[model samples]
Target: MTTVAARKALWKIPEAMELLSISRTVIYEQIRAGRLRTVKCGRTRLVPDGAIAEYVALLEREAGR
Candidate 1:
């Protein structure tokens, strides 16, 4: 049995892009830059919810600085 939060913890690339209103290119760029973290499951790349939140927090901190 999978809890809702457990299922939501991992997001596909397209899902993450949709959630963040960003393009595929932007997502890849973030991943490449190490600002966003991802994991590989078979051939699929998955982004964690925590990574997304951390990225947002980093941006917010940068904006504040």
Candidate 2:
């Protein structure tokens, strides 16, 4: 099994999109809605590993309700 350590702590927008199987619009929407957190460095936006996991967990919790 792959470990978390094997993954990057920070992911680019396209990488996040691919990993989440989501579109750029949806990502931006989520960010706008304060569902997902991100970091900005220069001209790049980065998603932290913890934020992705938190978003997924939030989805799961919402689905259970």
Instruction: Tell me the spans in candidate 2 whose CA falls farther than 4 Å from its real position.
Output: 1-5
Best by TM-score: 2
**How does model 1 score by TM-score?**
0.85
Pairs of colliding residues, candidate 1:
none
lDDT of 1 by residue, 4-28 (tens): 7434988999999998889999999
Model 2 Cα lDDT, one tens digit per residue, 1-65: 87675889999989999989899999999999999999999999999999999999999999999
The 10 consecutive residues of candidate 2 with the worst lDDT sum are 1-10
Best candidate according to lDDT: 2
Determine which window of 10 residues in candidate 1 has minimal summed lDDT: 1-10
Task: Tell me how far the alpha carbon of residue 11 in candidate 2 is from the true structure, in angstroms, after superposition.
Answer: 0.4
Report the C-alpha displacement of residue 50, candidate 2, in angstroms. Answer: 0.5
